[model samples]
Target: MARSTTDSSSSGSSSSSSSSSSSSSSSSSGSSSSSGCHFHYVIGDKIDKYVITKYLCSGTFGMVLEVIDEQGIPYAVKVIRLIFRS
Candidate 1:
């Protein structure tokens, strides 16, 4: 699996040496979001080097699919569902 990084720092905060209290809250929210799915990729879609083949199952949080790599090696891919604020 590949990893992505998110920087929580804002542009205005970098100008001054004094850090804002919201910075900590922003970072915490960023970390929480990191655990959730950021994209809704479908079957036959290629993520990185893995190609989604078939859906295996689904749960409250996400769905699991069968996938393969360029070498045809099989793998199980879990895609997380996005939660929208109402």
Candidate 2:
């Protein structure tokens, strides 16, 4: 699996709490997909308290991501794509 990182702005003290809260909510809802077809995750993206640290390799079924928890423990997460047939 390949690894990479994207650029993101540093959060300010005032916006930190709000952004964290929003990130938590959105992560739980799993509504990251903007096109409704696939999820494009970038470095620094938060998913259910886990922050994406790398862009791992992808396969036909889905893609793998390297994420870290609040404690700084790393983990690999596979995000499966859903295909609907007519």
Candidate 3:
């Protein structure tokens, strides 16, 4: 079995996500390819009362997506990677 982990810390009003992965295959490329794919949200998916609209962008930390509320007002929602740290 393989697993991945993440750690997050808050500095004042800012936060960060660190990704760690291990797999059956020893290939580093295999681990890198799976990073940031933890999120299950997609277009038309509803979460936190917001409906996912589009995938804006992504970084090593997380991804940002466009979402809309019931009122149709759009907003930028940041969905970070899963954090496994205690």
> Number of clashing residue pairs in every model?
0, 0, 0
Candidate 2 local accuracy as lDDT?
A: 0.51
Worst 10 residues of 3 by lDDT: 12-21
Point out the worst 10-residue segment of candidate 1 by lDDT.
Answer: 4-13
Q: Candidate 1: where is the Cα deviation over 4 Å? A: 1-42
Model 2, range 1-86, lDDT digits (tens) per residue? 23323322122232333333332323222333532426765578786667876654446766555566677656556676778899
Which residue pairs collide in model 1, if any? none
* Consecutive 10-residue window with the lowest summed lDDT within model 2: 3-12
> Each model's RMSD to truth, in Å?
15.9, 11.1, 13.1
| lDDT for each candidate structure | 0.46, 0.51, 0.46
lDDT of 3 by residue, 1-86 (tens): 01111222121121211111121112212122454646664468776556656555557777655556577655555557765797
Please list the residue runs of candidate 2 whose C-alpha ends up more than 4 Å from where it truly belongs after superposition.
Answer: 1-37
Error of 1 at 28 (Å): 37
TM-score of each: 0.48, 0.55, 0.53
